[model samples]
Structure formats: C-alpha cells, structure tokens
Target chain A: MPFEVYTFRSSGKRLFAGKNTPHFHAVYGIIAHKQTIMQDIQTEMRNRAKELLESKQAGLVVGFTLDEYGKPTPAFITDPDDVGRLVWNDDCVRSRHNLVGCLKRDEVRKLGKPAVVVNAAGKRAFNVLIAESQREPGDVVLIDMEPEPRDARFDERYAKLAMLDTMSREERFAFWKKEFTRCFKCYACRQVCPLCYCTQCIVDKNRPQRIDTSATLKGNFAWNITRAFHLAGRCVGCGACSAACPAGIDLDLLNLSLARAGETHFDGYRAGENPDTLPIIGTFSVEDKETFIR
Target chain B: MPQIITRQQLLALIDSLLEAGTKVATPVARGEKAFFQYLEKGDAPLIDPAVFPVNSTKEFFFPRHEILYTFERQGTEVLVTDARPFVAPQVVLGARPCDAAALPLMDRVFGWDFQDRFYQSRRENTTVVSLACAAPDAGCFCTSVDLSPETQAGADAELLPIDDDTFEVRVFTEKGRILFGGKTSESDKTGRTGAAPDRKFDAAQIRERLQTAFETPAFFSEAAVRCLGCGACTYVCPTCHCFDMVDEGSVDKGRKVKNWDSCQFALFTHHASGHNPRHDQGERQRQRVLHKFSIYPEKFGVLLCTGCGNCVRGCVDGLGIRPVLEEIAK
Candidate 1:
C-alpha cells in the first residue's frame, strides 16, 4: 500500500479516506450528494451507448469513465456490451474534450460512426461543422448532458470577460501577458476545441512561418491573439479550451472576447447556432460601419 | 555537516541562495496547482510533500526554447557563436523523487553518441534536493519501475520530513554538501519515508509484449483513440526529450534554436516526400510505449520512464503510460 491514499469509486459509498479528505470531498461529490442524479445519468449513458452500437447507428460511443482520481476520463466504447465501462456525472468537463472535433480525427473516424456527448457547446459545434460542411448531423448521435439545456457555462464565460471590457488595453495586455507566460505551447486548447479542426494549424507551418513557435511571452501573445481572431465568429463557447489547459490560463476569457465581438460588434452574430445561415466573417456587409479601422 | 533542519531554516537558506545570485527553482503555488518554476526572491516554495506540481523538473534543465548557436555571414566566412554554454548555479528544491530519478535516465541519452552541451551545462550547475513523498495519488507507480517515494537515484540531496517543521537531510553529492554544509543540525529523530506505491504492472511482461507485439497493437488498442494528439503528455514527461531545430532570423543574422517537440504532433514524422512512418495517432502512441519499455531499455539497460504519473495528470484525459502498461501486463 502507498500509505493510505483516497479512492472514490463508482458506487456512492466511500472507498478510502486519506489525509486529503477535504480536497477529495470537494472533487468526489461527498459534499454535493449528487449520487441519485449521477446514477440516472450513468444508466442513460450506458443505454444510449449500447443502443447506438447495437442499432449500427454508431460504431463507437464516446462517453466518460472515472479515472484513478475519481475524475471523468474518456471512454470510447466500440462494443455495445462494453458500454458497462461507461460512467456518467455532472460537474465533469464535457466528454474530456469537444465531441464534434473528435469525429474529424483519423483514429476516431476509422472506428466508423461515433456517438458523442453534446452539451450547449457541442450542439453549436455540430451546427458550425454542419454549416461549414465539415460533418453531417445524421452521422453523430448526440448524448445530451442536461435534462433541460441551459447556457450557464456560456453566461459564465462572457460574464468573466466583462472585467476585461472595463480595463484599458494596457491593463488587459498585462493581465493576458501574465497568463500567456504560463503557456508551454502544449496546444491542449487547440486540440480540445471543435472549431480548431484544421489539418495544418498556422503555427505549425514551416514555409514562411506565420507565427513564432517559441513559447516566449511575445510568441505566446501573437499565437493567442491569432487563435482568438481566427475564431472571431466561429467559436461555440464550449469552455473546453479553458478546461483542458494544464497551465490554468483563462483561455475562455480570450475566446469569449472574440465571442462578444462577434455578437455586439458584428451585427449580433453567433457561431454553431444554425447550419443554414452564413457566418459573419466570410460574409461581407457593404453598408456596414468601418469606423473601428481607424 | 549538520543532518537536520527546521522548515524555517530551509526557508532562510532559500533566501540566502537567492541573495547569492544562485537561481532557486521550486514548486510554487500557481492558482489551484503548484508548478516547478524558477523562483524570484520572497517567492515561497510550496513545500507541500503531497502536492505534485503541474509540470516536471525537466524544463529547468532542458528548456522549451534555447538558442543552439548564432551565425553572422560576411562574404565567404561565417562567424558562429555558441549561446549559453555555461549556466549559473541553481538549486531545485521539493522535486518529486520520480522527477529526480528521471535525471539519470535522461543523462544516459544526453551524454550518449553526441553530448548535449546545453543539457549537460544545466545538469552540472544544478543541485537536486528532492522531498520524500508521503501522500502519492493513485496514478503514481514508482514501485512498478523500480523507484520509490524516497529513491535517491538522481537527487543530490534528500529531505525526509521528521515533522511539520523539520526534515532529516541526506546529501549525495559535493554540490549538495556545499549548499547545506552547516545549515542543518544533527537530530536524534529521523524522518520516515513512504513505502513504495503498490506495483501496478509487471515491467518485464510489458516490455516483452512491446518488443514483440508491433503487429497486434494489443494493449492500447482503442485507448489511444481518445488521445487528442496533443503534446501535454510528452511535454510533462520527465524523460521524453524530443526537439526540433529551426532558424529564427533571416539569412544574414539567424540563430539556430531548438524548440521542444512531441511525437504526438501530426507532423512529427511527416517526411518532405509526404511519407509519415508513424501514420496515425495509434502508431505514434505505440512508438511512445515502445521507446519507454522496449527500445530505450534495450539500448541503455534501463527503462526510460520514472513512473511519475505526470503524463497521466497532464494528459487531456488521464490516458498515459500506466494504463497501457497495466493493460499489457494483464
């Protein structure tokens, strides 16, 4: 034994309590008492995963599994009977990443049809992919994370950005510089993001390299700014970029800044909302205000 | 030399090190997590024995971006200058033993066929002072790879906590001895280190499977599917040293710099002729497992990993070496 470590299992009962009780309690839902709700979600997840695989609706079901820490990890279920591996819970980062984005990966695509978790962010991601002809809606079977879809995450994402709105550009630059310095250029933000499904990212290009690939503060600043600007109107407000960042950077704030600009600055535009409509960026408005250019 | 030091004395020593212009690197609290970073004066070392910093200690030795050399062209002659061949003295305090153990494994490669002067310089100048772990998380598997919480493989000094305020210090190298010559006092009470974590997998079995099972791709069959192909795991890994060299400035005055690279990148093996030997993420993941268990071990007579679980903690979904090893061993 490793000197009594805390362990939280799928069962609601306590497994092992160690010195880090308060921390484990906070993470493991001992405080929330969410057993009943989580159990229901688990059953639904297994059932949906099983049905998708059995009915040939999906060859794979991308769901959740509890890791060694009792935190959610990705469970890619290819066998219907193996849906037993799946777990379900709230307070988890959605599907370990963007579900819509996973469909584009060659490994996942090789598995045939994939059913993936879709929360508020995922639906928008799916919608954006559809509009851009990146994926077909029929190809994916969505596992809705909420009983009633709410934009709580979306509201919180932009709500935090209101402080940035009040700050001068210099203060804002300082704030982001402090955050960007922590980035190791791991690209977790890009990997987890559904909208960032390009075969070749701009930073990876070698011929006449557009951005400095070094993890210097200046390089990070340019990369982050370019990343935000590129998704000016196409981000789905998933918050996965922020969730997946190991450096603990507020990447959501950067994306939300662009999300806000897409709405308030560009004629109330939002991405991944509707597949039939055109996006704000690619579509030009001749009668538009060009005052910001000055 | 004294053999015991109170927490206050340790803190004062850190201040002294900083005062003497020696770079002090320690795990410092960054938001909810602690990260191993070079500390400025007055910056407190986390000192929490249980907390594993969000990053490994490798970056302090082999940084993310370093100038290999600078070049200036004049007519037919080119003047080349090596950058930062000698590093200032530094101390790494509160490193996880697993992180410390990795230094020896890395030293093998860094000093192999071609000596990496950049890594060698930093390694020579830094003294590793590792903290014995008392509360390892479930993913930690030091025992599985022949390491323990207090393993002294790469540490210049070891600090075993006797209580909330004192540690039983043991020095291994001259650098460590010089750093703490008289700072500690002998104490009758010695600190106890945690027993090795429960062995998670059979290393010999996993290594054999990796050596023979290239066609099957057995263990990481579908698990690698969930991989986001991000550098998080490799970057956090203490022994995963892959880098790319690129010229920064224009032709006239450019510096050749080496930037950290990961095998998980889509273009890591993409040849100019458009052939990628590691065709997919699954193959790339297979390469990682093979290198750690089969390839490197065969060449060097030691496993390339320290079982720190940083890859698991840092990965997008906690799918790292342990899971694959455990599955293959089964």
Candidate 2:
C-alpha cells in the first residue's frame, strides 16, 4: 500500500500566507497575541518570585511553571536565579493542601519563612491554616493572583450538583455505585486535598480499620463518603479531587453538596473564609436554627 | 462472512446478547463523555467511536479487587476456602481498538509462568467486538505502538462505522460468528478497511532509546517533577496490570484480596527496612517508562502499550507519555 499523504501548511508558512486567508489570520493573530500577554504575565511573576527570594522576605517561594511538556505545574523556588522558571496561566492553580502540609515540615520551618503564590480560592485555604494555628499571618507572604477569565466548567459542575439532587434516591444510589466502581483506591483525592494533611489517614489504620482499603464497590463508597464527611465544614472547593481523578468521577459534587447544605442550614457559613469567624461545625449557639434537622 | 448492521440492529444485537444470559459491556454515553459499563437487557449501547471510554475494559477481565481466599479460625485450627471466580460468558461491544489490543499484551504477563485463573477465565469467556476509531486525537498513538484503529490484535470481531446509522462488521473468530448467528451476507460486505492514521513515533526506535535513557536522571526528574504520585494514569490504562494483595476483615476471619496498584505511589516500592530502590518520583516514573517500552518489549517482543492515550488524557497534570517518548527520541 502506498503511504497516504496530507497537504502541508506549516505554522510558519500559514503565518506568512494568512493574509490570503483572512479568517485564519484573524483567529491565529488573536491566539498569538493572547499567548504574548500570557508570557508577559509569566515573566512578571518570575520577577516577583526573584524579588521575594533576594529580599529575604521569603526563604522559599512556592510558584508554578510550564514543564518540558508545556503543562503548568507547581515549583518551589529557593534560589533567586531559578525564578525564571515561574509561570502563570489558566492551569496555574497551586494545591494549597500541599502548602498547608509543607508549612508543618521541620525543614520548611528551619528555612525561616515561606511565600506562596495563590489565587483567591487558594487564599481561603490559607485562612483555614491560620484558623487552625498552623501558621501566623506574618510568618508567610501571600502573593494574591490577579483575577483572570474564569473557566465556567467548574461552576457548571456545581449546577450539575442540582441535577444530581433532582434524581430519585434509587437513581442517586445507582449513579454513585456505578461511579464508585471505577475508583481504584489510589487516594489521589486525599493526596491532592489541602485539608486532608493527616500524617496517617484513617484507612491506613488496620487495628480497627474504619474504611476498607480494597477498591471494592462497598470499600470505595465508604472511603469516598468518609473522606467527604471529614471535609464537610472545611473544604475550600478547590476541585482538586475532580481534576485528579483518572476515572473522570465528579467528586466535586459530593463536596459541593455538603457545602450547599451547610450554607442553607448554618447561616451561610462558608469554608476557607475569614478564619476569625467561628466554624459552623465547631461552634454552637442557641440561636442556631435548622429546619432540615426535624 | 462480513456483513452490514444498521445502528438499530446493533442495539438489537446487544439486546439479544443480554437476553441469552450474556453480559454485554460497552461504552455508555453519559452527557459529554462515555464510560465502559455493563448494558442491561433492553438498555441502549452508546458506542461512540470518536470518544474513548474514561475507564478501559481491563476491569472486565482483571477486576480492581477480587477475593483469592477466605480464612476462619475455629478452635485453634484455621479453615481456608478458595474463592471460585465467576466464569460467565460475556461480550464487549464497540471497544476501542487500542483497548481491545491490550488484552493480548496483558495475556503474556498473566499467562507467563503461572496462569491467573480469574483473568484467564474472563479472557476465555469474553468476545471483544472492537469498533475502529473514526477520528484519532493528538494523544492517540496506536500506530506508533505497532497497532492501529483496525489492528484487531485482541478482537474477535471488528465493526467499522460507514455512516451515522450503519456499520460494517468483520468477524475474526468463530466466537464472532457465533455472536452474529452466521446471519452475515457477503453481498452486503463493503470491502472497506480502516485508513492508516499518522504514526506518532517509531516503536523500534523508542525501545532502543529506552535502553540508555535510564542513565539520564536529570531528564527523568525534569519530566516527572510535576507528577503528584497519582494512580489515575495507571488505573485508566488498558495495559497496566500491577496488583497489591492484602487481607481484609477481622483477624480471626478475613479474605485475602488483590487490588489495583500503581508504581507511581511511594508506598508501592517502600520496603519495611525503610529502603526503596525507586525512592523518588523521578526514579518511579523512569521505571514506568522502562517497563512499558524497554523491559516488556525485550522479554515479550512487543511494547506494553496499546496507545489508547488514556495516560495522556487522564493525567492530572499534563505529564503525557507521548511527550516523554518524544524527549527520549530526541
């Protein structure tokens, strides 16, 4: 058989020939311009990281950069010269769960102070860290990310939670059971979670195993429900579990459902907010009223 | 005999399979994507040739967790009972060619020294009816792995969609003939075959490059630094067959179960003496690449990847195998 051939219009030639095709030029031109702006943001972020490291304001700066595959990923910058590796884009959300765990490390404490690059969502996790007395506000530098165009897909999942709620009990049960069957008990959801930073998880305790470690349907359900319950009043809705799940399970629904229920019943107390405010789960008052309890 | 079946007939075929006490599994469309699932009797099968199911059909053969045996302590004597595997006949309808091909590649490992009864039994009972992909994505590289959308490496039958409502079925085995009930018509055969897609990389070259690639620790570290040590890639993979065995239940009464495990996890290689040969993420990542491209190919004369692109698509970060292989080629 002869090798099938495809007509070639290389990117370089396309750029030059794009004038002949106005449609291609317009689309490609906008994309190229957007990329340039993104690169500028990344360059500025690197400069900021370098300044923080040089000024001794932060012994270590946690940032993100594109890897060899051009995938945005988290990076811990200690040397000023390495700051050029930092990047900022749509995919540059830092897992605050990792930062929370890092702050507790003895080596990190020995380094004097840590600065972290975070978006508005990540700042909520910092509030939880402060409220839990994990770190003092002054002990760390918080580089708040500028608001960019938000991806509506995540918010769309929250809306899908409503769709899930509309399902009958049997339908919901069947849906969750089918979803849980794909879970391999990888603990990636727990690993990626900023709030699930326990040195030893409950599932690891074999003496009186609270949840089975096997990836059986029953075991998966138990693991998922327990993990969700553990973060009921504290999950910052980072959507890390959903992103990390290889099975494409929308675990954000479970967390968002709890968050919605908490908001409705507990005077709209949100997790990852001002740490000074008493937590809904921990606080009790005679004024606390709920119709769902009855 | 090759035959043509309308989309409606395909659904009816699935219905008939279920009616005959056969478990027919296929990719089921949810909203935006599809998942491999068991189609109940009268349920419609959503075989989207464009979309690869999130979970592979590997679970149909080798389950995530299975009981090997159960033990009970009675009066000082321990009573052990071997759990028998269920060996019901099944059909996998409209599986991706890449996923179908993984079955035979995995067979080498499962059947090498000692035959895995559970996997073997499932393999023996199930007939794979793979659907050739109409459109391969940037992540898809079945051609690079010495397989293609129409390779039929592990399939008993192949279905080529000629249009939105029609498919040309090609039988490869007696099992496929049995499933179709010898109702095929030679006159209806289209004589059409799947077009060859663009090759992502050369398999021979990748295997050769993988030999000395392990020496470059700096390259591996740079490639794997973003890895969160997650099992998403492995779990979704059609060929990854690593398993961990653990006993569950009370100390007196328990069942030894095998669960899916991944080398990406730190605990997968952790030794009791606190020594791990694959200690860092980079080393672990290197092992994974080596296992698929070098070690498996050296032993089995076949690459351990079917190039379904699940590892690339399922990765939490954009840590893709295609790009990693490209780096090795460089």
Candidate 3:
C-alpha cells in the first residue's frame, strides 16, 4: 500500500476513518515506520548538532525539541551539550518547517552560523532563498532528514491535491471562497512559509494600501491570492503553511497547483532543485512553453 | 438551587433561539478543529465541554473588523454615516468558563474611558452560557490565574455535566436567569466542576516578576527567537484585545474600520519617523507579558489572562503564555 501524504493532524483522522483511496493506503504503517526512522535519524541529528556546536562549525543548531506538552517544537540550541534535546520524528510538526528561515532573524544572526534541520522540501526552500538572494549558501548548514534520497516519498505530497483536480473550476472557486471566509487575517499562513520571507509584507503596507486591511470575504480573497501568487514558482510544497493555519485552510493545495505548473511549463524546472541553476522565475527563457500567453 | 436540562433539551434550546431570531455562537466542528461560529439551521454545535474552539468568543463583541463610520464628499459639503454596531440579541452557548471570564476583564478596558458602544452594546445584549470544564488538557492553566473550570466571572450561567444525558445549569446574573427561565427543572443533583487544571504558575508571582523584568530583555528574548511573529496566538486568545484603525477605501468615499492587530508584528510599534520603541521581537514579547500581568492588572485590578490555553493551542510555533510565565516563575 502506498503511503498517504499529510501531517499527523489530517492524515491520522482520515486513516482512522478508513477514508481516502486505497492507492494511498497504509499511511498508519508508514507513520509507524517513520518512527523507526526517527530512532536512527534522531541519533544522527543529535550527533551532527553536537559536532557542529563543539567544533564551532555552526554557532547555533536550529532543530526540534519536545515542548512541555510533549509536542515536537522548534528549538535553538547553542551549547554543544544541549544537542541531546534534538529530535527527529514523524509528528515533528517542525520537520517540514524551514528552520533555515531563522537564519534571517536578528536574534539568530547574532549567534553566527546556523545548522538547520531540513526535510527535502525545507532544503528546496533553502535553495530558493539563496537563488532569490535572500540568503547565501554559506550562511547556514543543512542537516537533511531523509535517510536516503527518495523522490517516491516526495510523490505523496500531491495525493490529496490530485483529488481536488476532479472538481470543476466553479467548484474549485466555491471551495476556496468558503475556505477564505474563515480566515481572519492572522497571517499564520504567511509567517510560516520559507518563501514568504518579505521584510515588509504587502498586507502590512498602508501607504497606497495595496490590499484591504479588513478580514471581509473580499479582503480575505485578496490576501490569500497575494500570498499564493507571491510564492508562485518559489514555494517548496512544505505543508508548513497549511499546518500553521489555525483557520484550518489547506493552503498547500494552492501551492501544489503552482508547483506542478513549475515542472510542466518550465521544461521540468523545479524550484531549488539545484543550487547552481538559476530560478525559473528569476531567469526567463525564450523557449518557455505557454498556451495561455498570446 | 441549580436547575437541570437534558442534553437533548440544550440542543433544542439552541434551535429555539435561532428560530426566534436570536443570534447564537457556539463551537461548531470543522475538519479537525472546532471554531466558535454563528449557528444556522441544521448546524451542529459542539456542546461537549472537552471541545475547545480554535478562535475566541471575543469576536462576537469586538469583531475582527468593524466599520467605525462611513463618509462621502458632496461638493463642498461632507457627509458622514456612523456604523451602527451589531447589537442583535445573541446567546453564546457552550463557552469555556475561562473564555467567559474574559468579558468582565475586558469590560473595564472598553468601558473605562469612553464607553466603547461597539463592545458595550454587545455585552449588554448577549448572555454567555459557559460549560464547566469536565476534562482539562495540559494547555489549560485557568486555575493559575484565579479562575477555575467553573469560574463565573463573566458567564451569565454555567453548565455542569451530570452525565452524557444531563446538565445542571447554575445561573449567575439576572440575564442568565431570564435566558433559562422556565427552561430548566429544579434538581438537587448539582453538576460537578470536575478536576481543576493543574496550576502552571502563580499569577501574583508573574505580575511581581514582570514589574522588575521590564528592564530585563533576556527573559523575553529567550522565547522571541522562536516566535514567528504572527497574529495567531493573539487572535485566538480570549483577552488579547489590541486593534488598529484605518480608513479603508478611496479618499472620496470609504469607511473607517478597526481591525485586529498584534504586538508580535514588527510594524505594531513602527513609528512614522522610522523609529520603534519596541526594537525587536523580544521587546514585543516583553510588552505582551507586562501588559497581561502588570499593566492591565494595575489598571483593572484583575489579571488580563483567563488562561483558556487557546494561545498555546493556536500558536504555530508552539510558543505561548504558559511556557513563558512558567519560565519566569521558575
């Protein structure tokens, strides 16, 4: 059975309900196996963090630590001995969270170099940040979570997104409209995205007031659209934004649409796939395929 | 003497209120989480005391975004129309006692200087019915903030679960009594408050530390590094009531509105002169603690936080008040 893709929140629910197609089945088994993976990777992560901090290879280790509530939370450890707090788990909500984004923060910057934990998607976004000139490759170290290179694991990212494609355009619009209505402009969706590392977000600007500041349906639509478009060709499909939304909006679906387009329209170009290659958005191609464009 | 109503009767009560043209807000299950939303016909309200809504009931009184007024230009003559605050008679059902307590704590702020009719009107028109916590999670710290699962600070009435079939209603105010008038039958079986949430910190100690910790930046910045600087925690909180006002729409014709703002945002204190007193996220974090513990309490004679634990639950970064306060007390 193929592994179903999603966070512990929705995935556990759907798995318990015996829902979703059987093609993406045994998500529970995969999660259990992922825990076994955690045992090995957690040891590896702690070792790497310890090495980085002890040798001063990195001034800070941005990783996951269990909070008092036993939830996997983002932690910053500077002391070499504190590396034991580091962890890797299937439910590490911070697993896909691009801890690399923390390198841009003042408090984190004051600590010198950062050694960040990153899954495939997090690594992709890290590369995107570099391509966009928001970061330098030398600025932070990446400790990859995947024990081995597995594009098949990344394939699970679009399992639910594939289901959404069955809906008509009107149905899609209605689906999103209802979802956007719940948004109260908390900006959790924006704050969590690695690609959305804007110093002054468009929503915050009031000089010309690019978008409505209200949380009205129209205003919310505007906000969500702005957030989605801004990350177009750049979003790494990390699911952090969707997981972060207290409104329970599945924002990753919007990113999936753009991500799939990035591969198709840009001749199999993927954001942050290669550090040496220029970004699809930043560098335009004369051979760029487009049916919609005149 | 307390009055009793069966589970079926309580749901019927919600339907009856909606049928009678009264707006009702309750936790309605949506996907994996529950949210406090207005109930319509056939909408199932989560009456279970264990279900904590992701968003607060504060929006019922102080909406996320509300029109202050509207204006238009007619040649040399200017015209203005004041936005009448929505004051429809509403019933907030199945609110946690901690959430209910936020109302009175906030009332002091809204009604202190200039009676904010927007909030005061809703406060006057609504009756809050809180469900006494039968099952409190680790996130809950209501007991630490001078509130219990059955605290009646702002609730008009309190519901106690006798079993899956029954609830004992304890009326606190005249408004609560009138709302439940004739709906309940007198019963000797009192609803239990259940186990109290284990106290996480002493509110007095936090307030005391905050008084001196104002100048100490490390205490706050320790947590600030991980804070994502989003409005999630503040918006979900029952008592975090900071707002930004702006004229929305064109200059010729538009409405002035107040929208929810958060101290966590970098721009919350950004000055017109490009100077900010709260220099960093650490300062902002400090302000949040000091305001809830020291500033508001010094002014209102009560702690600003009700310890509903929504902030902890809603924080995307998993950073919240309890952890910070506990760190301080330790």
Candidate 4:
C-alpha cells in the first residue's frame, strides 16, 4: 500500500527559501508490523505493529520499518488524493510531500473544517489549534488522529514462555532433549538472541579447550546441557533462539524447563517479568531456599 | 569388487588422501586429551571409538572470528570488500555419530531466513567421515535421544572398528562413495550390518521415571545446589549451539561479530538497560535443563542432547547430568 507524507507549509510565508530552509522534513512509509527500527525501539515497534497489522489495520502506519540489513530507509509522500492509502512498509520509503497534500485537501473538503493531524512524538509544544496559524513547512504541526497502541500478543507469547514452570521435570526433559538434538550449532540462536550478546565465550579461550572441537555425540551433549543450564532462571523466554534455529530445534523448551524449575524450587519466579530486576542467580536473599544442600 | 583396506591400509589411505591436496583433520592425542587437529600426511591420528569429542565442528564451517565483510572508508564514502573464499576441500575424520548428526541441525539455523553463505559453502565443500562408538561411557545416552553408537544420522561415510587393525567402512552418501572411489565389496558392506542396541527404557518408561524424579525433592535440590553456575559444560559441548553477537570498534566504523555464549553466565540474558532475567544459579540451572529437555523438543520433535557425556566429565562442581537422569530414571 502507498503511504502519504505531509510537509506542513504556512500560507503567505515561505518555509524553505534558501539552503538553510526551515521546512519540516518528515518521511512516512508503510512499515510492516514486527519490523525493527533501532535495536530497542525497533523490537518494541515490530511487536506492536505486527499486532495492529494482524488485526486488519492493513494500511495503518504502526511505526517506521527497517531494511534487510536492519537500517532505516527514508520515506516521503508524493500524492495528495491518496492520503487514505498510507500504510506501513517494513523498510521501504515513500515521499511525504504528496501524502500531506492529499490528506489536507481531502479533510478540508469533507469535514468543512481543518483536518486531523497525528503526532507520533506526542510533543506538547506543537499542540496548536488547527486554525491558529497557517501550517507552514518545518512548522511543528500536529496530526489530528490518534493511532492505537499496537498489540504484541504473538511476541508476548514468546516472552511469556519463561513462566512455564508448572510442568514436571520429566515433561521438561522429554521436551528439551528432542529440541536440542535438532540443533545444528548455527550461531543464529546466539545471534538473534538479545541475551547471548557476549564479548567472548569461554569455549573459545585458548588457555583451555574447555569444550572440544568435534561435533560428536559427547560434544553435542556437553554443549546443549551447558547452554540450557546457563540460561536457566535468567532466560527471558523471548523464544528468539527457537525461532532462529534453522534445524527447528525447540529452544523454548529448554528455556521454559529451566524457568519452571526455578519457580518451583525458588518461590515460583521466572525471567523477564521485571526488565529492571536483577537475575535470580545474581541476587541472594536471606530467605533463599537451600533445601537441596546436604 | 571394492578394495578392502586393512587398518594399516586405511591409515595409508588417510596419508595418501592428505597427500592428495585435501586438508585432513582427525582426532589427535594431546597428552591424555584428544581433539581434532589438522593433519599433515603421516600425522593423522586414529579415531577414538569409545568417547565423543568435546567441541562442536562449527569452527571449521563458521570460524570463531571470521571477517563477514570488510569495508574501507574514504571521506564519507565506504567500499565493501568481500571475504576470502575458503580454499581446498577438507575431510573430517573420526567424528562421532551424534557429532555428525549435529551438522544438519546447525544447517537449519544457518540456512534459515537469512542464508549464511560462508557456512553453507564450507558445509557443501567439506567431506565428513564418522566412526561408530565401540564403548559407551557412563554418561553416554545417545539411545535416549533416538540415536545410538551405530546411528549414521548425518554422516557421509561411517567406519566401524571391527578389530584393533581393521575397520568396516560403510558409505551412506554419494559424496562418501565418490571419496571411496566407488569401493563396494559385498563382504565389506555386509560385515557391519547390525541394528543398534535396544535401549531398555521406552519413552513412556522414561517419562514415568522422570516424572517420579521431579516429584522427589532430591532431584532438583541435590544436583542443582552444587552448580557453581559456570558454563564449562556448554563450552565443551558439540551440539550446544548458543552464541552471542557483538560489534567491535567505534560507532563510526565497526564489524558485527558472533561469539559463543553460555546460559550459566549471570549477564547472558541481562538487558542493555540494566536488567537481567535469569539472575540465579538455580534459574540458570533450570534453563539449562529445560532448553535441552523441553523447549528444544517442543519445536524440533527431538531431544537436543546426543548423550555424549562431555558435560558429565567437564563440570568442575560435578553437577553432571547423568546422575540427574539416573535419579529421574528411578
């Protein structure tokens, strides 16, 4: 779908007269839901956008979409009558000038008054009455529409797997073993995982070949067990690893199994519940249960 | 009739193959430890048919620190440089069954939505020659993961140690047959035919045992408490595929690199905004178990563990998984 980009221009005054033009330059593109922008915002935005898109807001602009290499693409509007066609593109850019003209003319003719402006930034300084000043280029004009918050239930489901600690150990083990055996050892599970961003790995240390270099059954067992244990109570259950596994290994089962154990043994707790909280292992409480101690 | 090479002849074959332009890598003895090392003609060591290797074979396909794409910057302009293509076909000898199986698992991740050309290229060009296990370790349980010492899940050719000096080599793929120069002898082919040992416990029995173990407080409290939260097991595992991605250099210009990651570390799942989800050894321990037992199986319809027992031998605190499984099996 095409997106309309609106550049605000005030009547009787020029916003862009010279090289140092004061015109407001805003680009709008139809970003696909679940596409990333920057690391953080992109992650949240994609989750929200995907929800909106799935709910049938086909032409809605959930947020800005990024390119294949995860870079932001510039967008602009070129058509005035096609204002309604503005939709989100994952990383594609469109002209904004054309979109704004179409949106303004259409609203003025239909509503008999000023059109609605949607301000993504929600800046209070730009909250001016529609008719107060002639909208000019670079003017901090507001869009009069309110975009609903995007729902991220699917992505949320991934994050919520950390809470699946109610299952018994047998259930957990049966589940994870099948999942891990499918592992191809591709670093995608590590690459796409936000939690796996370490500077150096213990396995790569030359001082000791802590882990061996062959893909033998013994090696695979050691690696997967170590990985699962490492992520135990701390895993946020984003399921990014499971999603990223090319062999279709069920990485979430491993994360969830650990989450379940932590909850049962340590007062039913899981990871990622509080993004601001410390990991369970890093923090020790006086009331920490040590029943397992001999 | 295919030529039947004796163990001495096989070693000669390896030497000749190494001499014939291929880079041969095989398990070499380092003091008491064994690891895969590049061979120079006469130096390739014999395959260890009793134990599995500790490390994954990913480095051969995807090097630990590979230059994905190098770029040179010149005053607001940047020129991208392609990485050097891998030269020479390599043969991996003495790989275990579970190790061989791991290639396809890793292949799925590398060839997923975004194709990793470097990994694919190496996988395509290299030849893998695996060995069957003659003796299973105390912690070895490939049978539990639907694999056995004789399972040729992902091997091109499999070698069974018949005696100290003779090997029964079975070619499973076209690449292996070509490598063996179409060596096909009826006696050689029929000599190694045998079904894998029937694992005593069925899935239901295992599940029941695991369920009972989970119910008993001893399983979780006893084994998990001793874990020092070090990822020694993962670092040495062949199938554990977790990794971390980082960028080196300043924001002006840098390259993103991927490194191995272990869940045992406290900061593994920590957020950039100063929050960590898995903060405790217990939680981390739980994650380790679940990832292998539950989450991985849920997605892939198979257990992630190859049952090679590296984790059992690698852990410092003796928080090996075998005892835990044995308890669960009880």
Candidate with top DockQ is 3
Predicted structure 1: lDDT? 0.80
Please, what's the RMSD in Å of model 3?
Answer: 5.6
The lDDT of each candidate is 0.80, 0.74, 0.81, 0.52
Instruction: Please provide, for model 2 over B1-330, each residue's C-alpha lDDT reduced to its tens digit, 9 standing for 90 to 100.
Output: 448887887887777778888898988876566778888544568876777777899989988888999999999999999999768999998888889899999999999998889889999999999987877765788888888666878999888877778788888998888887654445444634455557567778878777777765555765555566667788888999999888888879999998888988777887768788887777878888899999998899989998888887767565657767776766
Candidate 4 C-alpha lDDT tens digits along A1-294: 012323222222222232212122222332331233212332333443343344433323312223222432212212233332333332222211111221222112232222222322121112111111223323322231223212235434345564445558797665555445434343445533434434455444434546543333444566667777776766655454554343445666666667667767766555543223346675556665675532
TM-score of each: 0.91, 0.80, 0.92, 0.49
Best by TM-score: 3
- Residue A143 lDDT (model 2): 62
lDDT tens digits, residue span B1-330, model 4: 223446776676777777787877777654344556577534548575764454545557665445555555668897666666576788887787777887776777678787878778888888888887776654466676677777777689988766666667778888888777644334443224334444433433544444333333545543443444455567656666677665444445655455567787666787767687765555566566666666666666766677766676554323456556555556
Q: Tell me the spans in candidate 1 whose CA falls farther than 4 Å from its real position.
A: A1-34, A93-96, A151-157, A284-294, B74-77
Tens-digit lDDT string for candidate 3 (B1-330) = 768999888888888889899999999998999999998666798988778889989999888999999999889977999999777899998888888899988899899988899999999999999998877887888889988876788899989998878999988899998899999998888887868887668889878877778775566778778788788889999999999999988878999999999998888999999899987877888889889999998988889999889988988777888888888888
Instruction: Residues B1-330, candidate 1: write the lDDT tens digits.
Output: 338999999999998889889898999987887899899655778887878898899998889888889999989899899887757889999998999999999999999999999899999999999999887687789888877786898899989989899999999999889988989898788887876777567788888877678864656655568788889899889999999998887778888889999998878999999899988887888888888999999999989999899988887677877887787888
Chain A TM-score values for every predicted structure, listed in order: 0.81, 0.77, 0.81, 0.43
lDDT of 3 at A44: 63
Ranking by lDDT: 3, 1, 2, 4
Candidate 2 structure, TM-score to reference: 0.80
Task: TM-score chain B for all models.
Answer: 0.96, 0.94, 0.97, 0.83
lDDT of 2 by residue, A86-144 (tens): 77654563332234333443334455677777664566676776666665666667665
